[model samples]
Target: MARILIVDDAKFMRLTLSNILQKGEHHVVGEAENGTQAVEMFEAEQPDLVTMDITMPELNGLDAMKKILSNNPKAKIVMCSAMGQQKMVVEAIEAGAKDFIVKPFDESRVLEAINRVLG
Candidate 1:
């Protein structure tokens, strides 16, 4: 099972993602409420994958992705975007995010993205 990190500003979103990942048989290594915490937890937890919300406070997903990637270029990051954030999603991919999942999370898509990234 891959160690996964869930990063989102909403507690409910984090919990929902955690439940899904757990059901998928992946371990939820850490949960971060914002981008800063995401970066810090990434360092501490060293999770195999990260599901990062695009619009978080302090630091956005793209910036945090950059930070993590800078430290570890092989970091597998998946951007979680809400609708109408296509531009940001594209930017994230360009900025080193391995893949992305749109909001109103779907279990299948989430797992698919993670599998694709990890593979």
Candidate 2:
């Protein structure tokens, strides 16, 4: 299983994602509370995959994704989105995110998206 870094402003959301990925046998290397932290964590940890939320304080997921990709094009990412963030989703893909998961998350869908992106 791949090593994964989870990024979300909400602590519970990050924990939920951690639990889901850990159960799926992916190593949860770290968690980030905001997009700026996400980018820093990604650079330091260099995990096999990252699950990033689209909206956050300091910097949004798309900008974080761009920074990460700018540093490492091969870095893999999946955006954690909310309903009706289609525009952000497109921006994420363009920024080099491999996939996305919409919130209020379904565990199965979360796992599926992770697998599709990093499996």
Candidate 3:
């Protein structure tokens, strides 16, 4: 099973994603509440996958994505965004995100995306 690091400002969101990943049999290696912590944990843990939220404090997902990619070019990152941020989603893809999940997440879709990227 892939090791995943979940990054989000909201506790509920992080818990939700963690539960999904756990149920899918993927290891939830770490959790980060903001982009800064996400980067730090990533460097230390080097998880197989990362679920990163776009709008967050201390640093944004885009910048965090860039930093992670800079640290590890092959990093597998999936952007988590709310609706109406289509532009940011595109930028995320350009910045090396493997995939994205829109807010009000769907379990099936999230799993599909993760599987597709991990495989």
Candidate 4:
């Protein structure tokens, strides 16, 4: 099972994702409410993958992804965005995100993206 770090400002979103990951048998190493926390948790946890929300209070997912990638070029991060955020999603992919899952998340899709990235 992959160790995953979940980053989202919304508590419900984080909980939903945590449930899905746990049900899928992946270990949740940490959860961060913002980009700053995400970056710090990433450094400390060194999870196998990260599910990062695009729009957050601080740092933003794109910038956080950039920072994480800069620290570990092999870091596997998947962008999580709401509907109609295609532009930001594309930017994330171009910046080295392994894959993306749209919110409100589909359990299968979320697991698929995570598995693909982990693979």
Candidate 5:
């Protein structure tokens, strides 16, 4: 199982993702409420994967992804974006996110994206 960091401003969303990942046997190493914290955790925890929300205060996920990738080019990230953010999602892939899961996550799709990226 992969070690994963769940980054979302909303505590509820983080909890939802944590449960989903745990049920799939992935270790939830840390939860970050903002991009800054996410970057710090990325360095400290060095998780195998990260699920990054597209929007947040302090710093957005796209910028955070860029920063994380700048520090670790090999980092694997899966963007967690809302339904109307297709533009951001595509940009994420271009900027090095391995995959994405649309918001209001579907368990199967989330797992599938994770598996694909890990592979």
Candidate 6:
């Protein structure tokens, strides 16, 4: 099971993703409430994967992903976004995000994306 970090502004979204990851047998190494925290946690925890929310208060996922990738180009990050945020999602992929899951997440899709990224 891959170690994962969950990053999101909404507590419920983080919790939900945590549960899904746990159920998939992945270990959640940490949870970050904003992009800044996500960057710090990524350095500290060094999880195998990161589920990053596209929009956050401090720095935003795109920037956070950039920061992490700058430090570790191999960092595996899967972005999370609400429907209609397709543009950001594409940008994230172009920025080196492994994959993305739409919000109001589907368990199967979440697991699938994470697995693919981990692989």
User: Residue 79: error of model 5 in Å?
Assistant: 0.2
lDDT of each: 0.94, 0.90, 0.95, 0.96, 0.96, 0.96
Candidate 3 accuracy as lDDT = 0.95
What value of lDDT does candidate 2 attain over all alpha carbons? 0.90
Backbone clash pairs for candidate 4 read: none
Q: Which ten residues in a row have the lowest lDDT in candidate 1?
A: 110-119
Model 5 lDDT on a 0 to 1 scale: 0.96
lDDT of 3 at 71: 80
Residue 91, model 6: Cα distance from true site in angstroms: 0.5
- The digit string of per-residue lDDT tens for model 6 on 30-116 reads 999999999999999999999999999989999999999999999999999999999999999999999999989999999999998
lDDT of 4 by residue, 46-111 (tens): 999999999999799999999999999999999999999999999999999999999999999999
The TM-score that candidate 1 achieves is 0.98
9-106: candidate 2 lDDT, tens digit per residue: 99999988888888888999999988899989998999999999999999988898888999999988999899999999988887688998999889
lDDT, model 2, position 39: 89
Q: What are the clashing pairs of model 1? A: none
lDDT of 5 at 51: 99
Q: After best superposition, candidate 2 residue 81: deviation in angstroms?
A: 0.6
Stretches off by above 4 angstroms in model 3 are none
| Candidate 3 lDDT by residue in tens digits, 1-119 | 99999999999999999888888899999999999999999999999999999999999999998999998999999999999999999999988999999888899899999999999
